[model samples]
Target chain A: MNNAVLLQSVRFIVLVLLQVTLLNTINLSQYINPYLYILFIITFPISDKDNRLLFIFLSFLLGLSVDLFSDSGGAHAAASVLIGYLRKPYMRFSFGVSYQQQGQKIAQSPFSQRLIYISLMILTHHLTLFFIESFSFANMMYVIQKTLLSSILTLVLILFSISMFKKKQ
Target chain B: MRQIIIFIVRNKNFLLFLLLFCFSLGITIHSHIFHRSTFINSANFISGGVYGTVTNISDYFSLKTYNNRLIDENIRLREELLKNGISEIDSTVTSSTDSTTNYVLHRAEVYKNSYKAPKNYLLINKGSHQGIKEDMGVITSGGIIGIVENTSANYAVVQSVLNTNSQINASLKNTNHFGTLSWNEKKDYRKVQLTDIPKQANIKIGDTIITGGMSSIFPKGILVGTVEKFTFNQSGNAYIIDVKLNNDMTNVGYVYIIENKDKNEIEQLLETTENE
Candidate 1:
């Protein structure tokens, strides 16, 4: 009912739409497709200590949505869940819990920290996704080429999105 | 019962999120199993709606280049008209009474495409209504795209050469040594795996490969790709030739569907033998 939730939902719809359609079309070369939708999972409010569950749930959805949209191999699901599973540790590492009301407060995903973690997550996610999608140990050079190119574009978009959120906040 | 009801009502949002997440997982898990699933279909329907809107916005930016391509093709045709003395009405349906000449044309556009997977499929704009049918060879101006896999009233899904299931009978155009074109889940070279080729074949790095005449799906002499590398796979008798496809499926917009006149007869014979 609140404006914030409504706006977030609208943006989520927009990101999901763009992710499946426009960005999906931009193959950039066979291997260099940039997935810009991971931004949504990275920005979800840390609900509680069980935010891990939420992140796991959402990351799986995000990756699966991408897998469905991009016709990505099941790797997107596995990778997204991997990142989701890892988010709790990374968030704790980034936004240390020694501060006031750490237990009482759901750690806010800070903008800069969100960028760093998202960048790492996207990099690992895409690399694993592409590598597994390729399913070749011999094609390392080619897979690396795809991973680096896609990571660059993903990071740029992630940075731009974080900055935009910062501006609004 | 009242206490339990109160407990559920108190934590409804958590329950709601859990329910939705479970539903999404169920849908995704079932999507790949069958040709159709309501959940996958719903995802397709929703994703399709969203994709359409976004494509419309971005396709606007592509108009200039698209127009230029059309204009250039038009000018080239006009030049041919000047030299050969042709009529404007016969632009698309080109013909000559000369039996030696062979040309067929049918318009199709890509509706669904994939490049991320090793073996990708492309859904095209033409179908049975437009005379497009399964195994009708599809190609772009640059080179081979794929063979029509399945068809509906107005569309067909092309078994893109990138697909893991694709096994086009192809070979070196220069030497005429042929093999089967296939993919191995690697996105690179989408151009991977030309199997059943003889190890003794005169294949070289950069040798151009084309569909062999032995196929009913594609006419001979249509380009497949250039050989990037070759080696003996588990099957020692056959060489595993890596090929780099010529037509870039990533940006393929328009294509032409080629139907062989004798395709029906060939398929019928193959089917009977298959049943036997």
Candidate 2:
């Protein structure tokens, strides 16, 4: 396999392990369970934009693995696939023509640009996950609080991990 | 055929996303408490094995607390034995010999639990092999926990009272006025909502709530919760009451699976009556 595929495979395994064994156990508060696994999809190579099928499949697999361990049924899988579907549009929207022309790695982007990209991706992911898990809009405030807090926590962790292990592009 | 192929190739990405998204949503719906999700629950082999191992490890660290809970339950049982005699204490065991006994309780340990979700479910170690079946009422010493939703060969999944779909027949301790007991999906695990009580029913804060026994699943007087607060609904004809659950749903360790002895017979009679 090529370097990108190999690297993504390793990241998938590592993130799933971290999520199930470590992160999922850390229930800081009822509403603040940080889901750091979505970072796998967040940092997935944008060069693979043409290979949408592979991207969606990998996202589904990643989410199903986490759901199996966490026993959350398919909430994660649904949310992850949604993020995977929207990733290209979001990147285009955030970075505009520069993203398409340069094919720049999102992690290597300027801090402000990267922040918007990661925050929106994480927010969409967390909102879908919490909503599907609840399957109801009855407790609107509770859902909003969970989505906001978890998105912030996930975004921070993803940003930190990206900075710490950023490739020398 | 060329035109069809072109169309397929043009929108392949959107089509694939729709397919997978719907697949995942189907899974979510199937696993919901409202659906009779007998399969694909967390009690399946792989997930159950992982959770069981994790619970086993955690159970060791909480041995002291577990032991204390068992001791407390034992004391309560002994007190009941002393006060009500062996027949009542052994109600779960003596149902075969005594025709009057309506419910039998079997002990099971929790394998996994989730309270943070809007629709929480509990995995218990007992299953069909242990005489546990779907729709059987489950409880701890403190009060009602939930009803068994599905069971495998060696495990069962409980639809916790914390779930939005849970609706149990519950009544006031002092009066016959009863309502449907359900959860508001709030973060707090200690509270549930009781609705449909008529406005004229004299209910006060701290008034006890228990199983109405109108249904065959739970016996009469099984403690459910206590009325915490109440308000008149928009119609002004019924009251919606907030109930404080007696059991801490998040901390349940051991539970009792209640099997109503005459459920099948009663259900059959009802079916016949309806048919007639």
> Number of the top candidate by DockQ?
2
Among incorrect, acceptable, medium and high, the docking class of model 2 is: medium
In the predicted model 2, the residue pairs found to clash are none
Give stretches of model 2 more than 4 Å off. A2-10, A17-28, A68-73, A100-104, A136-142, A167-169, B29-34, B84-100
lDDT of 2 by residue, B1-276 (tens): 999999999888888888888988888887764467534566677667766787887888778977988898899888877888667655477656664467788999898787777778888988888888999999888889999987888888888999878899999989889889988766377789989999889989999999898888888788988889899999999989999998877688889999988999999999999999
Candidate 1 collision pairs: B119-B163, B119-B164, B120-B163
| Model 1: residue A53 alpha-carbon error in angstroms | 6.3
Candidate 1 C-alpha lDDT tens digits along B35-73? 222232212444445544554566676688667767876
lDDT of 1 at A45: 58
The share of true interface contacts that also appear in candidate 2 amounts to 0.52
Tens digits of per-residue lDDT, candidate 1, A14-117, equal 78766766676675566667778777766665644333554566677677666655544455666666666665556566566542245422224555655666
